[model samples]
Target chain A: MLKIIQRWFIRYSEQDRKLDKAVTGITGRRPYNIRLYRLAMKHSSVAAETVKGFKESNERLEYLGDAVLGAIVAEYLFKRYPFKDEGFLTEIRSRIVNRESLNKLAVKIGLSQLVEFEGRKRSNLSHKSIYGDAMEAFIGAVYLDKGFHFTRRFIIRKLLMQHYDIEAVIETTTNFKSLVIEWAQKLNHKVEFNISETRGSKHNKQFKVDLSVDGEVVATGNGFSKKKAEQDAARKACEALDIP
Target chain B: MLKIIQRWFIRYSEQDRKLDKAVTGITGRRPYNIRLYRLAMKHSSVAAETVKGFKESNERLEYLGDAVLGAIVAEYLFKRYPFKDEGFLTEIRSRIVNRESLNKLAVKIGLSQLVEFEGRKRSNLSHKSIYGDAMEAFIGAVYLDKGFHFTRRFIIRKLLMQHYDIEAVIETTTNFKSLVIEWAQKLNHKVEFNISETRGSKHNKQFKVDLSVDGEVVATGNGFSKKKAEQDAARKACEALDIP
Candidate 1:
């Protein structure tokens, strides 16, 4: 009985220490409400519950965090690229907050060691996206605990500046729509994309996008998303016309 | 010369008085940077200028305001609807902040009387969206002058509570996509949308959507936006099939 009691105490203390370390590591301060941080780290697959008996998941926090992150990123981009148009700002923001980018950032911030989820949830959850979700939830928790200004500072100064190469991202990213538009402008040709047909059931429908150059169909592409199909068609048109 | 000078003096004081009234009406506090508020009310067509020699319009401020508004709205929705899924929250947010809604809200706040733009600019600018843009710029100015916490409180308590019927919006606003999905489930039938064909040029393309029910095309719709086209198709399908 004494041995069992000792084991339980050691495990409990270890867990407590780990949580404290994570709070300190992420926020650079002692947490005001450790429960929020704890909830942030708990993935929905674990079915976490609040002290008030409300079923809890990081999903709501993720939503809030996503907005917070967007606002901060938008402000940073707006100030950094004062002369850049809204399209440029939006594209840069997307590149920064995209699932792939966020996933990488979350791992960089040591969330991989801290987040909790059931192994079974791995069936549907991509290994990377869950971490991204958790990162958003963590930001949401930070927003709630310390408020927007502090969260903005944490995201902009601590997370984004520390991890992302903003200049490199701006230089590297290109939109196919812009590429097609530029090509059209240079060649003095008009290009258009129209949805000739839509197929499938409501939610999981497929889009068939046809790209036309100077009133002639140049290429066609298919995707579940219209944007994807449009991009696909543009890429093909680019390849076919040798206008890279 | 004395009469001309007197006229200029009177006009300038009138403009100053109008600005002060506008600020007090919108923010409920005296503005610190009156120039920012003036810039917020200035439309691009008017070609307003700052003392710093930058061509001043509300565009950059609009971008900042959009992000700030989105963050505040997201937080409000997150807290108010704890159990709602991300899609529901997103749809609701879209309803509240859409161009049409914001335009109306801007007018409600008496921005129509205050915002300045050239008559020539009005030819291309849809009367509604310009106000919405100005509203966002106004919010951006508020965020800058007052900080995030104050801006958040203004958005949530002053703007939203005063102007909007939150419960009515939550109850009445139904996404066409969601409506179709629910109808399909009730009838135990499968439905889908597929993009069969696309036409037009790159940026100015139209979407053609065909709604299929039980392996047959029931209705077709065309629109500039995919979502609009889809909603059109869905509504037609709903009407034809008596799927109310």
Candidate 2:
């Protein structure tokens, strides 16, 4: 695959060798398949045209990649920071693995140099999200080539363990209820969650809550479980205040 | 900001100079203050427990990062794929730049390295969403350090421009209505959303939709909006089928 991408990159890139070397320098742990890389690079504009009447592209891979990446990262964080709660986990993750970040990372690793687009839309294209999708595709490629254990090690070595405060980062992203409450306290205000009712039974109890600050409801939420309910309620409050 | 971060990373990463080079290489063009780095690294726990009693974690930064990331990614997709419509753009952004993705990226980029913990719950504490939030904090740091231009450049270079066929990926995510139809067609089943109408004028309209598959009513939903009604109906159907 790397050979194929090497061929493809050689064909279009002005600084073909340099680009190849740069991308390879960072990603050359294992070679990527050319066919996959081709699909990764060809914009939907050209790829979706259906060569040989085939309707396949990297869409499924991207979808899978999105989920797989989330699962992998979630598992990693889960193991790395056992003390962190859900809210902190959610917010921090929102910051890092986003489409924009992955896309930017892909470009930094030189995926941009390999991309091929058409339709005279370079200056006016709408395929920006592809940047990250391609990165996922690349991950998919690596997964297929190297397997999960290898991929995990590669990600940890190249990505996670590279630089991080795993303990503190995990702790912060985990607790949103605390985060919101803490914020309200900082404002020197009393926070109250007016729970109108806990409607369901113990097995499937649902709580309806309205979180308020200084008498006005800031967030309304319902959850099947009590803890989830309070967290949901707090999350709503945070969103309403635009305060993480 | 980059200079400060570079210097700090170089100073801290005394053993692995390769990582130092990688960190400095990514942010070589900018110069950020140590305060920004500290803020980026400050998980809410440490910030909340500070001696000054000032809770100044990246939580606020996470909030800002979420919105800014959304706007920038939206704009990027809009420009990158000139032919795509609003729904496509939104769905792609939703999938690619979701909280889960951001969390993964944050962890990938070492946001965990900056967190501060509360109790000794590190052993059993496990929350998965923080990586993205830290990624957002990092974005906040980048924005604070380099402003929007470089921040935009940073996101583009790192995240969105890498892999997926952005157009098709977006198209795949957009328009659940069409998706249902497409899925039904593929399954050789008739899928109909029967909207039983209630009386209303131009200003107010109420709709009750009975979503059916293969002539069997699946779920019913009532909404002022056809879109909402459809979504609720779809959600019910999906829930009924335990889809995903």
Ten residues in a row with the worst lDDT in model 1 chain B?
B3-12
lDDT string, candidate 2, B1-244, tens digits: 4465565653444423433343445555534444555555556765654432235676756655665576567556645754543444556788877777766565565555445445425552535555566677667666666766677777887666543345555434225566677777877989888887664787888777888999999888666777667766775676676543
Chain B TM for prediction 1? 0.66
Give the residue spans of candidate 1 off by over 4 A.
Answer: A1-16, A48-55, A120-126, A174-244, B1-14, B48-55, B120-126, B174-212, B215-244
A149-179 per-residue lDDT for model 2 (tens digits): 5656666666556544455553443376888
Worst 10 residues of 1 chain A by lDDT: A3-12
lDDT tens digits, residue span A33-134, model 1:
666777788888786566433557888788889999999998889888777656568778989999989888888989766788888334635466889999
**Candidate 1 interface RMSD, angstroms, 1 decimal:** 3.8
* Lowest-sum lDDT 10-residue window in model 2 chain B: B10-19
DockQ of each: 0.33, 0.02
Residue A197, model 1, lDDT:
76
Per-model C-alpha lDDT, please?
0.79, 0.61
True contacts kept of each: 0.69, 0.00
Q: What is candidate 1's lDDT per residue for B72-140, written digit by digit as tens? A: 999999889877767568868878898888999988988766788888345635566889999999998
